[model samples]
Target: MAIAAASTSSFPHLNHTLFPKCPSLSHHYHFRPLRVPFTVRASSAVVLERDSITQPQVTSKVELFACPVCFEPLIRKGPPGFNLPAIYRSGFKCATCNKTYSSKNIYLDLTITAGTKDYTESQPARTELFRSPLVSFLYERGWRQNFNRSGFPGPDEEFNMAQEFFKPSEGGVLVDVSCGSGLFSRKFAKSGTYSKVVALDFSENMLRQCYDFIKNDDTILATNLALVRADVSRLPFASGSIDAVHAGAALHCWPSPSNAIAEINRILRSGGVFVGTTFLRVSSTTPEILRPFIRQRVSQSYSYFTQEEIEDLCSTCGLINYTSKVQQSFIMFTAQKP
Candidate 1:
């Protein structure tokens, strides 16, 4: 990518302390000093210097995040690198919408209603339950373990299965949609399989809980991982920019599964992969008589889908190569963007 160099006057918010002072130029005639900026671009880092005499200040430009409202690339100001600390200190702004998004506590808020104060909306019970602070704290501690009763196979096995499905997307960007408490996001980042991993969710407390688990782990913190607050139905990414999307046990909780899946397809590249896990309404072992009752009861809270329905949904959303593995109520499915 070409690096566009411009005068510091354009970005008035840039801290002068971040750069070094230029050497004095002495001449016979008295004239106004010209402040020229030099930028050195690299694959991993970008350095900006005010003058040749001073040391260049290294900073990283954020290009992965986009405006949730306008679907435009966000401009970033502040520190370099993709680490947690660098991202925390950075601020993102959308040029098209003239909207600014900043880090709330630790995670960046990129939702359409991120800055809204008077307009409060409530999500369905299934989505709002995870937003509670208490529930967010217990998600990985004990809540997720309950899935074993329904044949979840545990997190270690699930992570391995997802990894196998995501092999084609190696060295690419991965987004963990609805990543409550980031149980799988940390693993994906540590594996070094993807160039970057985004842990995205709508719950504020869930993101805070994710940061709590990551703050003490230097190994995972140093990876190219980002925590963002965004709605699943309206993903914040440019068209065909994402390589892989993983929603572990999250599809059933979405307000609208069709809208969410379509949004996922919109963000994925032509050959990108999407892997997700959710609870099926009724497994093969379920009694024929009880199937209807189970479906009715679950439909009141979460939108559990049958295996066939899931395949149909993926196909309808422009995804191909549909396949799945089922064990009792638990199901892991995969689809590719064509």
Candidate 2:
């Protein structure tokens, strides 16, 4: 039988007796199976080599999270699963850039500037307002209820409408962008409509509030729900990897709606759905004389868009089949990735 070429470097743990120093014999010479002792040694060496070859496969599962810097799929190490507990225990690292990400508090921080001590940056006032502990604490209490004045159909109705729009994306990954205090993210997880629901926000206090709400509910806590801290304009996921995106009462608060929508388009796969609700600059029934004044006042604080502008922005971002339901200053829009 022909002997396989084996290098000492390849099998450093093997005994040197396996390869006898015989100057007369070539390295590629055929070997005859003579002794049982030699066969046992060769067998053990082969077993070791096989184990070495297959060792990397043990931790080869790619995670849904990607490196914010390079956007490469992260390799997960630790307990496996998509639940909050498992993700919290696990550590993620990008093979391409070798950057590591882990749960800092109760949530995984995937923001571009996650770990800089001296380079902290402040966002616009609209975006930074939610980051305050006081605002985060009051978000679900009474602040959110104030949206009724703007004609936002209550959260229950809004959730139902969003669920209706999200039917096609059932049993897939759904990301709740700008999920302040996880009002709708908790509902999405409890509904069991998606295989995984990511409650993502840029505010640290908001994620803490989300975890606070989730910790008490075993049903939602045991589900495939994850709280992620990330910027909407620079979402931390692989391109074309997400199935659905929801932004509720969040468009006006983004620093740049166009950039945020474009990032949403980049993350969604073909046929994926995007649903969002926001305050419009002016409703169709608004008096023409008061329209400019309302626009000017709202523009100074938040970037509110009209119905036509919302549709135009969606189309310009490469999303198609745009549709909306407008009620006074509130508009809920849906679009699809082509």
Candidate 3:
């Protein structure tokens, strides 16, 4: 792969800080924009500078300003001040309204290149495949790609629940399992409510994405975010070693949620908190008709549990003082391990 020398401005070796000269054997990260037909690659940990054009370069910053639905910026209309190759300067599009962004904020990063085939998968034989497969859905939906998943009702509400649950709940410890990019976990990490913030995910790519978000000095020292890759049911830490456990949009992904829940109970200190969010079913409409179509588009999370079933599960596990609510299509729950 071609490499670039990140130089500061128009000077030669301006001697500015570069991303710590790469890290352990670097792995290429393949990323794809939603609704787009292409994938991009970032070679290893190479720092991308604005100068010293030594390698291929591109970025999603422009798309960030544009609408995903319409592929245009949400700002102002303009001929554009910056020049680009015909292919690179694709007009600005909005991610939500699909409108065009007509402002100066909509600039594109030219550091990214076409991604490799290694990170992609062959199309599933059947569209209903997502119903049974969890990881594949995550991999495709840009799990760690910063897609602003806050739009998902279930996941969004659960995040709100966790936000409130951990708030005012003084200093202790917290763990977020199957955390994708640790975005919601960042709430507690930023709240200063926990002594230790552990962000656990089964995918290293996910963890790398988390680091990408929390690598700044402020986060490292203030939140004390620790990245760990471990199964939800079988964590490497000792039993009862954790004080609080939180998960966002991860319940359905686990192969055996019961075991994971049980482990969560075991790991919490007598008053440690467990705040989590996961997808749940809202429309009881006939699954027969929508199931096949919906499942084909994306792995509809496991038929989300009803509020009653969730409460029952918590009760069966001996949880006390539980709080639950149904928002849109998600069931958000939190319980104390008394």
lDDT of 3 by residue, 140-231 (tens): 35653442342345345445667677663457667788776666666667767776666666654565555556544354434445555455
Question: Which candidate leads the pack in lDDT?
Answer: 1
Residue 28 in candidate 1, Cα distance off native in Å: 51
Off by over 4 Å in 2: 1-61, 288-299
lDDT of 1 by residue, 281-331 (tens): 888689888766764636688898888899999999999999999999999
RMSD after Cα superposition, model 2: 14.5
Instruction: Choose 2 or 3, whichever is better by TM-score.
Output: 2
TM-score to true structure, per model: 0.84, 0.81, 0.51
The CA lDDT of each predicted structure is 0.81, 0.79, 0.47
Q: Tens digit of lDDT per residue, candidate 2, span 1-338?
A: 21232333233322222332333211322211112221101221111111334333222233678788888766554444577765664455555675666676668889988767799899999999999999999999999999998898999999999999998899999999999999999999999899899999999999999988887688988899999999999999999989999999999999999999999999999999999999988876899888767646356778888888899999999999999998989899999999
Candidate 1 residue spans exceeding 4 A from truth: 1-62, 287-299
Candidate 1 lDDT: 0.81
Query: What are the runs in model 3 whose C-alpha is more than 4 Å off?
Result: 1-160, 167-169, 283-303
At residue 95, give the lDDT of candidate 2.
55
